[model samples]
Target: MSNDKIKEDLPAILERYRDRIEATIKPYLSLNLTPDENLTWWQSKFAGREKSPGGFPYLPKGFDYPQTSDGEYLLLLAQINFAEVPYLEGFPTRGILQFYIADNDSYGFSNYYCELNYPQSNWRVIYFPEPDLNAENLITDFDFLPEKYWFETTELEITKCSAIRWTKKYAPICLEDDSAYKLLLPQIGEAVPFELEDLYEEFTDAYLKILDNDGWFCPLQMGGYSCYFSDDPRVGFSEEEDPFDTLLLKISLIESGSLFFYIQSSALAKCDFSKVLYAMA
Candidate 1:
């Protein structure tokens, strides 16, 4: 078929197969970035660098829950888990677990990685190696670009896939006491100089990479805890306030791809740190 014909027909085909498509895609999808062909291409850009920021081997800081001398929570890392399960014969097996820390003032480091054949019925557990940890290393800036298309294969079929692109900004966080540590910036890639519409296009393209590549069927989950001072007046009613609180956010996405249904579980802070903080829980 002509490229134009395929383009014109795709919308109708997608509409007609919407239900089936959803069933095929839902089980493998997750938030953040989907590593499709474009992601591979983007990664390739940094592949030849002798000092490339290690991508897969490094773990985000706070993942181990570092504590201060007084035993107080100092930093935390967000955890992301991804997996692929094939019910059909001949399909390739794949999975990953990654961690992230949005830029924060109190934290000093960050890291991410994946697990192969995670959550299997058996006892085997393989932890993927990560890049080296640099105390001065931070995600200085990031750009979530439009999706890119690529080709992939399952045991039963060969297909095209889409993926999202992101560029992160990193920098060193300097404290008042002159103790400095690296920090990931707070802004999303959407705030970059690109046009808003272009940004959305990039995001959609990247997201489609996950779907087209059958990314949605994998079982994936992400979560983390954060502590900071809250100014809620109710906390200071009787005496000098403690001036700090904790917040926790957890999310999980599970999909089967063939059935296209997914469950997203998200939990936010339910109480103050003085009561039932996540660090202690």
Candidate 2:
């Protein structure tokens, strides 16, 4: 069905489970930037430093670019200057954060026993708490990167850059996961009659279908409920056990896949990306 049709039917979905789903609502910053093949790397930086999907990240003088375990340079997946982003809880008010992934076929996702392994060797999340704004001090030469890695996998080229405009919006849970439902059950139960006990699956499916169809779920966002194309990373953990409370970033990949970075609130506050969990779906 078309997005207009789904949007027209959204009211019905909301009215049916208004109380239950309302509690799941959380705000997120929507990144509005379209990748243009014609735009040169210099043109992307014309708007000054900003958030981008794939770009030459802001590298200070002394900092070495992130590399995989094999010592190959990781490609920039996203660069987020928190100064350009709105204030989000548990998120830095100022800093330049970058997500780098391997240029390999797997996009640097390393798995163990068919499950995502922690302390990922192929991907990296670097935080520059105090970004030096001097352009001359940054590394300008990026010709060393392999040319094949620049191709656009989706609409966005992995190597080209596009400046981002932030739009703060509200979102509810998109994917269905038992752990997530259980975690929010208490709050949802308090608002209504615990109707989700019988209608959780049915309601969630219908609601998410509308949201997804209408493009309400962001392919790249910050500090919001994660909308995965496949499985949610924190699906197995219990309510009391917090695997990850912060959705650091989510980047869409080819074939409806996504790369996610999750971190604890405390760790994020400390500007520590060491313990952040990397997941691909």
Residue 25 in model 1: lDDT: 18
Residues 1-281 of candidate 1 have per-residue lDDT tens digits of 12112222334323443333333211121223332323221121111111112222123443333233343322112222222222211211222222222122312112211111112211111222243235344332222211212111122121222222222111111111011111111122324445455644554353344223212122221111111122221232224232121111222212111111111121112111112111110
lDDT of each: 0.22, 0.60
Model 1 segments beyond 4 Å from truth? 1-52, 56-264, 268-281
Tens digits of per-residue lDDT for model 2, 106-220: 7676653112345656777777787776668877676766543422433344344566767776665554443445543444542345645446555566666665521234666
For candidate 1, the lDDT comes to 0.22
Model 2: CA > 4 A from native: 1-20, 34-54, 112-120, 148-159, 175-178, 183-202, 205-216, 236-241
Clashes of 2: 0
Model 2, C-alpha of 72: deviation from truth (Å)? 1.0
Estimate the TM-score of every prediction. 0.17, 0.73
**Which candidate tops TM-score?**
2
| Model 1 TM-score, all chains together | 0.17
Worst 10 residues of 2 by lDDT: 41-50
